[model samples]
Target: MYRHSATPRPYTTVVLAMSTDGKIADVARSPARFSSKSDRTHLETQIALADGVLFGASTLRAYGTTLGISNPQLLQLRQQGGVPPQPVQIVCSGSANLDPQMRFFRQQVPRWLLTTTAGATSWQKEQALGVGSFERILVADTSTGGIDWNNAFQQFFQLGVGRLAILGGGELVAALLAADLIDEFWLTVCPLILGGRTAPTPVEGEGFLSTLARSLELLSVQTIEQEVFLHYRLQRS
Candidate 1:
């Protein structure tokens, strides 16, 4: 995993639901509502275990709202652990071109924004007018105009996010995989196959060479009716 020697970052996990052919969404890039209620509950359990939930701009736009803990037992667990009822919902975007009217702004969970300088400038005017919804904004960009993930995770650690969950739209997961920042993955494979050339996968970047591909160690596998849940840990070098 990518770790800063001077700073301890959160233990990051990527949670996703994909079709049997490995498509997270259809060609239209619409919200992924194909998963069953069991999968939804599984996702909620993972979110409840995390200190923060992160998603890319595309995922946020598709859903228009972040998932909050509705299960009473999960809420009680968070209370017993001294964390808020809902984990901080974090949106990671480079441009931060988000609609303020989206239902996400009205959600009861704590919100955080992770963006670059240019993105932050777009929101600064709103914050000045006291119309911003984010409780915290972090700008962590690299010299090459990419996200400085190490720095970003260090900031997350400083903010008390010891465990981070990544809900994907593919691009974000690919970036973290490229940086070797992701630690674990929870993949739910549904029965259907969404066959489209433009469909999004769980990790979508230029992809890695066979020689440099990341390795994963299988942790567990569970089969439920029509879906299979696979848990894997990144095999760190």
Candidate 2:
């Protein structure tokens, strides 16, 4: 596993709502609306706690709008904590081939992008044309055309993001997991079965061998109605 220096990155937590069969989205990969309103509130609560929320391009494509804290109490709490009303919403993409007209760009929240040099160049051109919305574009790419997880997180820390929430579309979570950068998870298992080989899960990439699979220590579990809310901490060796 790749380890970072003594500089502390954000305390990263992944928040996801999956079906009973461990699928985050169906085979069609449309916006998953199977979770209940309670689950939405749970997600907003998690988002409210973070300094920034990170998600991938595919996720943004699936749901053109990012979740923001709308609960009045949650907004009040943020004010009391001396932070902005909404946390920064960061989109991570290698190619930065995002729609300029997505509803996400119009949302009243701080927006940022994490991408490669090539991606930044393209998006910067769009910015010059007055069609870009990202307040900051961070470029941290590896030689193999992949993101440098350690470098990205270090930049996140430098931006004063002490707490980060990962809202995933599987591949992003898998990359962070492989880097051993994720700290905890808030998983909500809804009462449904999205059983399809092509369906997306909370973690997706090349499957891990049993010997190399990461472990999680269950922190807590709660049954609300038919949904199961599970909290876990990644077990580091």
Candidate 3:
């Protein structure tokens, strides 16, 4: 298990589903059902376990996700954990070109916008007041074009989030991986193969060199029909 530092912060977990060839979406960047029903259920279970659920701009635009946990049993589990009935919904957009009218913002949950300096300006003008009832958090300046991952996590800690779930677009996951902030990874591998040269993978960015690559320790695995679910804990060392 990756241990937390002296200061309290959320356990960052990335939950994603891809095909056997490891593509989140098809070549056209269009959304499609690649994972099984079981995998979808598992995703809800993970969401129920989190204090906050995060998504990147591209994912949001592609799926128009509501970020809601639909199962009543899952809601009960959250209640038992002493977490809120609905986990906070968070969206990170470096460019802040999000549409306020998107279905995600219409959902009833504490929504938060984590954006960089450039994003703040775009958001203020494009998104009207009371449009989406989200808390705008501006991360301090950093080299990353997007909000600094380290600073965002610190802010999440200050907000009392103890477990955060990431359902991402590859670039966002890459940023977290580069910062070494993600603790656990849950990957659902569907049986199909999507062999598109332009298809997005689980991680995309200025990737680490072979010698600098991070490692993971397999935690558990579960199979349902043709789909396989994998759990791995990041080796913090």
Candidate 4:
């Protein structure tokens, strides 16, 4: 909804799996496998529909995600829809100090990096090593000292991205929420408790005060085994 140009931005959906205690990770910072097989299947389905999938660099480093379409049927569907066989994988970092040898860079899908001026300058010395063709999208904002997602997303729209899926590490999700850019949420709640003060949640930016919080309208809910999947539409003011 935070459109900067006359043309519309991509439809964005934040997809995450959290524990019953609302934690996406434990205190040890390990990736949580709280979701079941069905939940992962749902995520893959969504990925097939999107033109690209975005995640924070920390999330990619922590989970080692390639952001690929594993199902042959889904890959065919993507081709039929005129999108690439695999949705592009987009990673963001404030410092851009990512390990080029990581598995994420080895994937065949298109890859992009979203970063600030400082981050791009930091990576100027390294040469691309078959890291899929990369497109660096820079967002400069003096006030925030970070990315201006509204402008970044506008650039995405101009690049022919009609829909984008966000697979998160919380900070990116929070930024999109605060900027009012995400249109839907797909959350899977598992039957486990990961109680820790330092545990990561699905959203971790400057939270809105209770009175100023955005509202959500539950669109659908499904239960598969011990996991419950919830879909919601953000209700804008």
Best by TM-score: 2
Report the C-alpha lDDT of model 4 over 1-237, residue by residue, as the tens digit: 335436578999988899998999999879777688888899999989888788998888887756578899998887787778987788888788788777776677788888888877666555444443365555544465688787778778777788999999888998888877899999999999989988999999778899988899999999999999999988875
Give one digit per residue, the lDDT tens place, for model 3 in 1-237: 235566556898999999999999999888757777888899988988888888888888898765588799988887887778998888888787887888877777778888888888777776557575476555545785747677788788778777899998899999888877899999999998888889999998888999998999999998888988999998864
Residue 91 deviation, candidate 1, in Å? 0.4
TM-scores of the candidates in the order shown: 0.96, 0.97, 0.92, 0.92
Q: List clashing residue pairs in candidate 4.
A: none
lDDT of 2 by residue, 1-237 (tens): 123447678999999999999999999998999999989999999999999999999999989989999999999999999999999999999899999889999999999999999999888888888875999999999999878988999999889898999999799999999887999999999999999999999999997999898999999999999999999998876
* Cα displacement (Å) at residue 6, model 4: 4.9
Of the candidates shown, which would achieve the greatest lDDT relative to the real structure? 2
> What's the CA RMSD of model 4 in angstroms?
2.2
The clash number for model 4 is: 0
Candidate 3, lDDT over the whole model: 0.83
Q: Which 10-residue window of candidate 2 scores lowest in summed lDDT?
A: 1-10
**Could you give candidate 1's per-residue lDDT for residues 127-163 as a string of tens digits?**
7776648999999999976678888988998889999
- Sort by TM-score, best first: 2, 1, 3, 4
lDDT of 1: 0.91
- Which parts of model 2 have CA positions greater than 4 angstroms off? 1-5
Which candidate order results from sorting by lDDT in descending order? Answer: 2, 1, 3, 4
lDDT of each: 0.91, 0.92, 0.83, 0.81
